[model samples]
Target: MNARPLPSLNILTGTEVQERLIQARALQAAFKKEWKRLVETIAKTETPFQSIGTHEYAEELAVREVEQETKAIEGKAQRLEEITNGSIASLKKDRQRVGFMRSKSSVLTVGSNLSKDAGLMASLGVWADDFEALWSVQKARAASEALQEQLDKTKEKFKQVGKKYREIKFKNQLLSANIKLVENQCKELEKYRAHETRCKSKTERLEKSKALL
Candidate 1:
């Protein structure tokens, strides 16, 4: 069997790569848990508002929609994790098979003289070729898996960053709205005080005019 070259796998930065993988897994799990929590929250929210009419129904529906979307995302993330884990297992099995075939080939070639036992040697060659083919396929699968895993991690990272940005943006908006409301209230109070002072001054002037008359 002609040995094929293994591709270089230097993309990973030692323990850092493992750390990222662990973090990704943890995040995936967290998302799943969060999804469940969201579902529960939605259910609880709905229960209280169920007796109300369409407005409350609409709010409940919106909550359910959000929960559904979250669940979908969590499912996809978990699926990606499963695919990566499966690929790792497949690669390990392939490696073992490759090693076994190499040993078998060495043992067979040592005793079989191609000149005297051409047919037998041909059979061994066929076996070696089969093993080589399987090994090549396994190698390709592993490479594909590695690329996919990297892509999944990148996508997941973006998802987390986006979520964080949205949360901060929402909080900022709420704060701004609250501040505006307070400012409006202050303005209204100031106007009321000014009107009250004018009324009091006009009343005092009328009293003085009546007393003089």
Candidate 2:
């Protein structure tokens, strides 16, 4: 028998898995927002650098803030990804269990039908021939059932692996978006550094001119 579709199996337990995925996406968005906030904070702070004491101290503070924010985002993203993956695993296991139970049901059904047929044949005085034929049929049915059970198990395993792969895909998307934001932040930071340098130069030049006056 052909295996039941795995995607359809996901519907066996709906909404909960989708909710978990939604939450994961939310966390990813939060990470993006936090990163944006950090960059904005840096941009705002950069505008005030001329009077912010030593240049080293200002740069040090900016570096520390970025590091802290990035770490927080990474930690949150990691946890969210784990949660999503765990939910997917649970769904996969549940589907496999259901499939196994159905396989057992199929076996029981076949056995019940065979026994009923054998009893009818015996009552009709065809006992000798029916016994021989029924016994062989039972054996063949049992063997087929066992093989189908094994196939079901293998299909379940593949489904579990596929679910895990889907989770990985989600993580990759999040990482890609985060990386792009980081690159943009780096460019912004460079601009801040360059602007700070120009400010410092202007300040020093003005001081020198005042001394000569």
Candidate 3:
């Protein structure tokens, strides 16, 4: 059985979208202006001499006409909204498809490369004709890797120590401030105690003198 080919989808470009948007905006502006003009010409704030061949008043007729115009424009605006949204959604889907294709290609390429390199990695020591030279290179690479690991560990340890030091320094500062506050309070208390003692001694001498008299 023969299958029919699918119909091609038409996509709007950026310019077409912009043009449609401008057209929709122009219609909206015209709708508003037309409504305003009808209000000024046919509809009046006061009761009219004539109702213009209808039982409704002049203002009521104007409102009906404006409502009719609004319905038409509302349909157009809705269609324009649909077109804009559909175009944006289509573009997003196309972008996602392209990204998926690229990732798939990358995965396939990596798989092919890994298959090719698997044998070479297994026979790493025999890759070079000179066994001694290859061994020296491998040794150097191992040493470099070891050094890099050590450096990373040292950096992590230093970071931990530095954070701990900062915490301790902050606590020390708080304790120093507390000690200074307590020292000031102690000095104030000493002054108040000396004053109380002097007042008590004077009162005692005056009482003794008054009792003798």
Give the candidate number with the greatest TM-score.
1
Maximum-lDDT candidate = 1
Please give the CA lDDT of all the candidate structures: 0.53, 0.50, 0.49
Clashing pairs in 3: none
Q: Report the lDDT tens digits of candidate 2 across residue range 1-213.
A: 222222212121234434544565677666556544544443464222122232224444544544454455456555545555554555455556556655655565455777767655544443344445445545545555554554455445434533544554466577667555555555555565566677677777877888899
Query: Given candidate 2, what's the lDDT at residue 201?
Result: 75
Write the candidate numbers in order of decreasing TM-score: 1, 3, 2
With candidate 3 superimposed using the best TM-score fit, by how many Å does residue 68's alpha carbon deviate from the native?
86
The digit string of per-residue lDDT tens for model 1 on 1-213 reads 222333343343435545554655555455545544543443474222122223214334544544454565566656656665665566566666656766766566455465436645655765665566556556655666665565455455435534644554455456556545545555555565566677677777877888899
Instruction: List model 3 lDDT by residue over 1-213, tens digit each.
Output: 222333343434445545554655555455445444543443352322133332224334434544454455456555555555554555455556556655655565454767657644534423332344434445545555554554455445434533543554455456556545545545555565566677677777877888899
- State how far residue 62 of model 2 sits from its true place (Å): 46
Model 2 per-residue lDDT at 61 = 51
The C-alpha local distance difference test score for the whole of candidate 1 amounts to 0.53
- When 1 and 3 are scored with TM-score, the better candidate is 1
lDDT of 2 at 56: 26
